[model samples]
Every structure is written in structure tokens, then in C-alpha cells.
Target: MKILLLTPQFPYPPHQGTTLRNFNLIKGLARRHRLRLFSLLAPGDAPAGTPVTDLVEHLVTAEQPRRSMARRLRDLVSTPLPDMALRLWDPRNFDTLLEHCRAHPPDVLQIEAIEMAPYLFGLLAAGVRPPRIVYDAHNAETLLQRRAFLADVRRPRRWVGAVYSAIQTLKLRRYERRLLRSVDAAAAVSEADAAELRSMAPDLPLAIVPNGVDLSAYDPRHPYPNPYGRSGPNLVFTGKMDFRPNVDAALWFADRVLPLLHASNLGPHFWIVGKSPHPRLRRLRNRPDITITGAVPDIQPYLAHADLFVAPLLAGGGTRLKILEAMAMQKPVVSTRLGADGFPVQDGVQLALADTPARFAARCLELLQHPERAAELARRGHAFVTAHYGWEKIIPGLETLYSSNDTLTGASDRR
Candidate 1:
């Protein structure tokens, strides 16, 4: 099959969740199909000579459109579309897709995330005979926004952000329903996410295609350099620090959980590892116990060297690729239930799970003090992800979706 993939960003480095999913899906799909990728490049993102270039038959990129805050505010007041629908709206990208469809229509047009839904909308609005469109819901946007609203509403200081999310949640529901109904097939990263999407369009044909890791790249046996100099039982959380959920998670863990660990005299150093530390997080640099590495070339070293991986995410949708990466590295993990939302592992089987700050800290302390138990959990986690959460295991479901005659005809009839 010839597939045309649309992504919000170039998925080469795959450092972040969105890019990781897109990159792995492309790599897996390319094994049996011809792929042409159309991606919007973020500032400073370069695709030349990247491994992704080799995976696709052809690749095209356009600068991601810059939307001013004023424009976003204006849209919030005047438009029914969610913020995401307008985030990547660019005429050039629409024109590029149209032109390609006219000259070399693909067998399937696989839209990577909600941010890229504008192009699918554009193609349909233009009355072009689109190929079988596959909407890959990275997160059920409505559900994600709902979770954000719930998380932010309790804090008086964040009421403004809460209001924004509350409004976006409604807007996303309507927008997502239309997009799902229009697509030939849809995919969600997990059963939990798929359930949320199903609530929007009950009859929509959906498949579960969870996020996965490249096992070889995250091998526990690799000789990754110890990035934490002068560390005593380093606890690491990795993500794009600028991301709201990550920012929230890092702050929550540092403020509420780390102090508890300290009070117990466990004295574990916390490392926030990723690119683009938020201003709120950057302020923590003054603290001697916390080391905020702004950006690292590779995250494997951080994961490999960590004594424990902590995910204290309070508000986020989708299964965390960071957790999977950590597990693939054979490191013990302690996460909030929300952080481990979509995975099927038991609380003590794969990794420890806790909700409250004290419990979270206790779990970390327990794992830190018991090397044998930690190693057991780490081994189980490694085996669990290796058996289930690999690109090779996840990609076949997507391929099956693409090849299903019922999915193709059923979607075309709806249109």
C-alpha cells in the first residue's frame, strides 16, 4: 500500500511523545508499504539526513504556522473550533496536500494527530476525492481537555487556564466528532483513549494502536554514560519540559513528593531531564538537590543511569511513551495511577503505583531501599513492555486497519 502520512512535526529524533509515536509508526509501516510523509517543522527542527528520511519514499515539510496569542484569544471568542484546529492552520500545507492528491493520490492518508486534522478538513471542504483517510487520535482531545480543566479548576491561580480548557473541551467534542465521522478509519493509542473517542462517534470504526518503543535503542545493557555527576540514588522524570502536563508533573513531584522523601531522610536527588525547561521549572535550579538539564542529545543515558524513574503526571491523556522508555531501560518506576493510566500492569507487578504525594514518596523510598524488589519490578516491567509495547507488536493492528475492506467501504459510505 502507498500511504501518505501527515504529522505536526518531523518525527526523526522522537524525543517527545508525539514525535516518538509518529516516528515509530512510520518506521513500522514503511516495512511493508510505500510512505510519503508531509510534516510541519517546528523552529530549529531539521529533517535532512535523519533516519526518518530513509523510512519514507518521499518527505515534504512546511514551517509550522505561528499563531499569536492575540489571534488565539480572538478565536476563543469568535470561533467554535478548538485551539488545536487552528494551531497548525496554514494555506501552504493545505495546498501541498491538494496538489499531491491531484497528481499522485495515495492509498491512505494517515493523519497523525488532532493538530494535523485541518488538512483532512481542508481536503474534504475542497470537495476533492480524498483517499481512505485514517485519523490517528494521539489523545482523545476532548477527554484530554476535560482532564486539564478538572486539574486546573481547583487552583485559583490557574482558573484562567481552567476556563480555557473548559471551553476547549466542548469545542473539541464537536470538532472530533466531525473528524471521526469523516475518516475512513480511526486509531487510538490505547483502549482508554479509544473509549473516549467512541463516546463522541459511537459508530466510528476505531482501532487500538498503542505507542511503542524501539527496544534495541533502549537496551538496558547499553553502556550509557552516567549524566548525573555526584548523584545519590538519582530519580529522573523525562519529557518535553515545556509541555503543560510535564511542567505540572515535575512541579507537583518536586513540591509535594520530594519533601516527603527528604523528611524521611531518603535524600534522593531529582533530575528533570528533557528539552525546554519551563520558566517555573527553571526557578528550581537554585535548589541544590534538583538538577534541571535543559536538553540532552539522548534520553537513554539519563534513564540508564537513574536509580528510579518517577512519573507524577496529574493531568495528561494517552499512554506515556516516557514510562515505556523507562521500562525498556529496565529501571524501576514509581508513578501515579493517572501516570500509568492505560497500561495493563498491576500496581506491584510491573511497577509501583501511588496517587497521593506521601504514598508516592513512600513507594519511591521502598523501591530505593529494596534493591532486590526494585530489580524484580524492573525486570517485570522490561518483560511486559518487551512482550507487548514494541513497535513490531503494535504496528500490525494499524496495517490491518488499512487493509480491511469493511473499514474502507463503511467509511466511504458515510461520506
Candidate 2:
């Protein structure tokens, strides 16, 4: 079948979570379907490797919009939609998507994330009829924004973060609901998000196509004994540093959890690895024990070298791709329930789940001190992902959605 995949960003290089997920899915589906990827890439942020054009039928890159004051004012007043204010204002992206659809009318058009839904929905209204409309619900953007708003409760300065987030949340929720009603099928990384989408539209054709990793590229043995490991025992937290949830998680761990572990005779080093280290994260850099590597070329080494993988994320949407990747790398992960969503692995057998600071720190300490138990947990986690969350296992189900003509039960039986 001929398929068109619309993405918010260039999926090559695979540095960020969304990019990695899209890249893996495209690579997997390209093996079976005639795929054409139309991605909106930010100006000057060229992906390191060749574009998706070589592997697929076609690849179109659209310039993203700049967040200027004029844009903000226009967005607040005259925008038809929230995402339109943020992204669709760029006429080039709209033209690019429409042009591609006209040039090659695909059997299925898979909107990869919430951000791209605006363009896809707009194109559909403009009479772009692709029989199969698969909304790849990466995350419930509304819920994510809601969480962000809630997390800002303690701010005394009274920033407009909450108000802005709420506005975006409401706007996106409406857009998502409309898309759910209009689209042939929808898929999310987590059942929780699928449930949320279903709540918006009772009969929304929804499925759970999870975020995935390339197993071959992220082998544990390949990146073991990393350069960053020579210091004390490393406890690593990996994600986009500027992300609010990740920032909150890292701070929660450092301020609330680390002290408890420190008191318990666990003198562990902390490595927070990701791009765009926020100011809050910079504060932790003063301590000799904490090192913030702002955007390394590769993260596998950091994961392999670390004694433990820590994901204390308390607020966010969608499954934690970092948690899954750590599990796939056979690392003992200590995370909150929120951090380990969607992947149904036993807490004690595959990973350690602790919501509170004391319990979270204790879990990390337990995994660090007890090598046998940690190894067993890591082994079990890897085994679980190998069976359930592998790209090979999940992609066939997605392929069925794209290929199957039935609207009511779009390849649900195969799972």
C-alpha cells in the first residue's frame, strides 16, 4: 500500500524521543509499504545523515515558524486553531503537505503526532481524500499541558505558564477530538492516552502503536565501560533537559531523593544527560558529584556505564521512551508509576517503581548494592520488551491498520 507519514520534525539522527520513534517506524514500514515521509524541519537544524527521501518514495521538508512577539500576538487573537498559531501559520508547510498529497495521493495518511494534525485535518477539509486516516497519538497533548499547568502551582512570580498551557490544552483537545471523529483510525503509545482519546469521542477508531527503539543500535554490551564511569558509582537520568517534566523529575531526584540515598551510605555520582540543560539543572552542576553532559553525540554509553537508570518523572503524557530503552539495554531502572507507563512489566521482576522520594532513592540504592537482584531485574525487563514492545512485534499491527480496508475493526484481531 502507498502510505504518507506526516511528522513535526526530521526523524533522522534520532537524538530526541519523538525523532527516534518516527525514524524507527519509518525504517520498519519502508520494508513493506511504499512510504512517503513529509516532515516539517526547523531551519538550519539539518539532520546529520541523508534525508528519508532515499529509503521512501518521497521526502518533503517544510520550514517551521519562529516564536516572535508578532507571531504570539497574532496567534492569541486571529488563529483558527492553537497548533495553527504555533505551526500552521507557516504557509509553506501547508503548501508542502498539500502539494505532496496532490502529487501522490496515498492510500493512507498517518499523522505522526498531535502537532501535525492541524495540517492533515486542514488538507482533508480542502478535499485531500486518503481513504485511511491514522492519527498516531504520540501523547495526549491536552493531558500533558494540564500536567504542566498543575506542576506550576508553587511559582510565586506568577508566570503565564499555566494560562498559556491551559489555552493550548483546551485548543488541542478540541482539535484532537475533531480529528478522532474524522480519522479512520487512531493510535497512541499508551492505553491511558487511548482511553483519553476515546473519552473525547466514544467511537474514535483507536489502537495502541507504542514508541519503539532499534535493538541492534542500542545493545548494552556495545557501550559498556564508558568514559564517564571512572568516577564514583553513576546514577543516570536521561531525557530532554528543557522539558518541564524531565526538569521536575531531575530536581525531585536531586533535592528529595539524593539526600536520602546519601544518608544511607550510597555515595553515588549523578549524570543527567540530554540537550539544552535548563537553568535549574545548571544549579546542580556546582556539586562535584553531579555532572550535566549537555547533549552528547550518543547516549548508549551513558546508559551502559551507569550503575542504575533513574526516571522519577511525576508529570507527563505518553510512555517514557527512555525507560523502555533502558529496559531494552538490560539496565535496572528505578522509576515512578508515571515513568513506566504502557509497558506492562512486573514492578519487582522487571523494574522498581517508587513514587515517593524515600522509596525511589531506596529502590536505587537496593539496585546499586544488590548486583544479583539488579541483574535479574534488568534481564527480566529486557526479556519483556523483546517479546512485547519490539519494533518487529508492534510494526506488523500498525501495518495491518494501514493495509486493512475494514474501518470498524482495523486489524485489531491480529494482536
Candidate 3:
């Protein structure tokens, strides 16, 4: 099959969550199908070392729009479309993509997430005949926005967030319903998301093709005793630091959770590792106990040398890929229940779970103090991922989803 895969970002380097999902799925799909990857990459941000181009027959990319906060907010209220989806809207980009498709249409089009769905839909809106459409739902966007307000730590922003979330929630819900009504098939990253998509379009050809990582590259033993750098009993949290949920997690954990560890004289050091640290989160560099590594060429050493991998995520959708990477590295993970979404492992058996600051902090402390127990949990966690979460195993399911010719089972999607 000749497949055209649309993604919001270039999937190379596979350093972050969205890229990880896209890169793995695309790589796997390319094995069985001739593929053209049309991704929206921000200018000057292309990654090296990963041979992503080698996997596809053709690769196309568009410069992502960079909007200031003032303009972004203006568009948010002015447009019925949620900015989350609209951010990927580029009329010229669509023109180029549409021209290529018109000249040579593929067997199918797989729009990776909500971000890129608009591109295909836009072409259709312009009366272009689209190929068999597969809308890959990554998150229940409305639910994600709702949680952004509900899980926020700052009281002053909560009310304002609630109002904005309420508005965007309505917009995104409508957008999803209308968009799904037009797709031939759909797939989601997690069962949680798939269930939600089913509610919106009960008969859409939807499947669960989750985010995955390269198990071959991430070895617990290989990165153990990392030569990168070392400090006190280290606790590491990894993600795009500028992301709202991550920023909230860092502040909430620092202001509430990490202080508890410090008060106990545990002398535990917290390492927040990721690129593009938000200004708010960067302020924590003032503290001696916290080491904020803005961005590193590699993250394995930070995960490897850590005594405990912590995820104090208060709000987000989809499975946490960082948690998966940590567990794959055979590191004992301590996370919020939401943080550990889409995984089958038991909390105590695989890792620890805590929702509140007290519980979250306590878990970290316990894991740090008990080396033998932590090591055992890490062992089980690694085994679980090896058996279930490896890209080689999971990618086949996604490949099948791409190749599936199942007729839509429900009522006709609006033409």
C-alpha cells in the first residue's frame, strides 16, 4: 500500500512524546507500505543522527507558525476553532500538500493527531477528493483542557482557566465530532482516548495504536553509573519543561513534594531535565538542591544515575512516554495514577503511585531509602516493558491498523 502519513512535527530524534509516537509508528508502517511523511516542522529545528528520511519514499515538511501570547489569545477568542488544532493551520502548506496529492494520490491518508487533521479536512473543505482518511486521535482534547483547569495549582489562575477551558472544550468537542464524521478510519494512542473517540463517532473504524519507544536503544545496564554528571541522592523528572502540565508538575512538586524530602534531611537532589524550560520553572535554579538541566544532547544518563524517576503530573492525557522510557531503563518509577495511564502493571508491583503531595513525596522517600525493594520494582518494570511496550512488538499493531481495509461499521460518515 502507498500511504501518506501526516504529522504535526517531524518524527526524527524521537526525543519527546509526540515525536516518539509518530517516529515509531511511521518507521513500522514504512516496513510494509510505501510511505510519504508530510510533517509540519518548525524552521531550523530539524534533528540529526536519526535516519528518518531513510524510512519513507518521500518526506514533506512545512514551517510551523510561531505566535506570540498576545496574538494567540486574540485568535483563541476570535476563532471558533481551538488554537490547539488551528496552530497547525497553514493555507500555503495545505496548498502544497494538496497539489502533490492531486498529482499523485496515495492509497490512504493517516493524519497522526488532531493537530494535522485540519490539513486533510481543509483540502476536503476546498472540494478536493481526499483518500481514505484515518484520524489518529492522540488525546481526548476536551478532557485534556478540562484537566488543565482542574489540576492547576495556582488558585488565582484556576477561575480564569476554568472559563477558558469551558470555551475551548466546547469548541474542540464540536471540532472532533465534525472531523471524525469525515474520516474513513481512526486510531487512538490509548484505550482511554479510543473510548472517548468511540463515544463521539460510535461507528468510526478506530483502533488503539499507542505511543512506543525503541527498547533496543534504552538499556538499564548500559546507562547505569552514567559518566554524565552526579550529585546527591538524585530524583529525576523528564519532559518538555515548557509544557503547562510539566511546569505545573515541577512547581507543585518543588513547592510541596520536594520540600518534604528536604525537610526530612534526606538530602535528596531533584533534577528536572528537558529542553525549553519555562521562565517560571527556571526560577528554581536559585535553589541549591534543584539542578535544572535545560537541554542535553542525551537523557539516558540522567535517567540511569537517578535513585528514583518521579512523575508528579497533576494533569495531562495519554500515557506518559517518559514513564515508559524510565521503566524500560529498569528504573523504579513513582507517578500519579494519571501519569501511569495505559499501562497494565500494578502500582506496587511495578512502581509506586501517589496523588497528593504527601503521598507523592512519601513514595519518593520510600523508594530512595529502600535500595533492594526499588531494584526489585525496577526489575519487574523493565521486564513488563520488554514483554509488552517495545516498539518492535507494538509497531506491528499500528502497521496492521494502517493496512486494515475494514468497512465502516456504523452509519455513513457525512460526505
TM-score of each: 0.96, 0.92, 0.93
Candidate 2 lDDT tens digits, 1-415: 8989988888877887888889888888888889898887765557445656666878777777667767776786576477432653466678878887998999999988877777876797799879888888788777777777776655644357767777777887877778788788878777778778888988665667777777887787783557584665789999889988999899888888988888867688888999999897878999877789998888888888778999999779998889878988899999998888766766798899999888898788888889999999999988876766678777876765664553433222434
lDDT of 3 by residue, 1-415 (tens): 8888888888877778888888887777777789898888866557444578888888877888777889879978788988787787878899889887887688888888788877877878777655577777778787788677676434775677677777888888888888889888777767777777888889777766666668877887683456336555888899998887899888888889998898778788888999899998867999988888887777888888888999988888877889889988889999998888767668899989999999898888888788898999999988877777777666555544544575332111210
In the range 197-246, model 1's lDDT, one tens digit per residue, is 88887877777777889998999998988888875789999999998999
The top-ranked prediction according to lDDT is: 1
RMSD of 1: 3.6
lDDT of each: 0.88, 0.79, 0.79
Off by over 4 Å in 3: 47-50, 223-228, 403-415
Off by over 4 Å in 2: 47-51, 73-80, 83-85, 154-160, 223-225, 403-415
Best by TM-score: 1
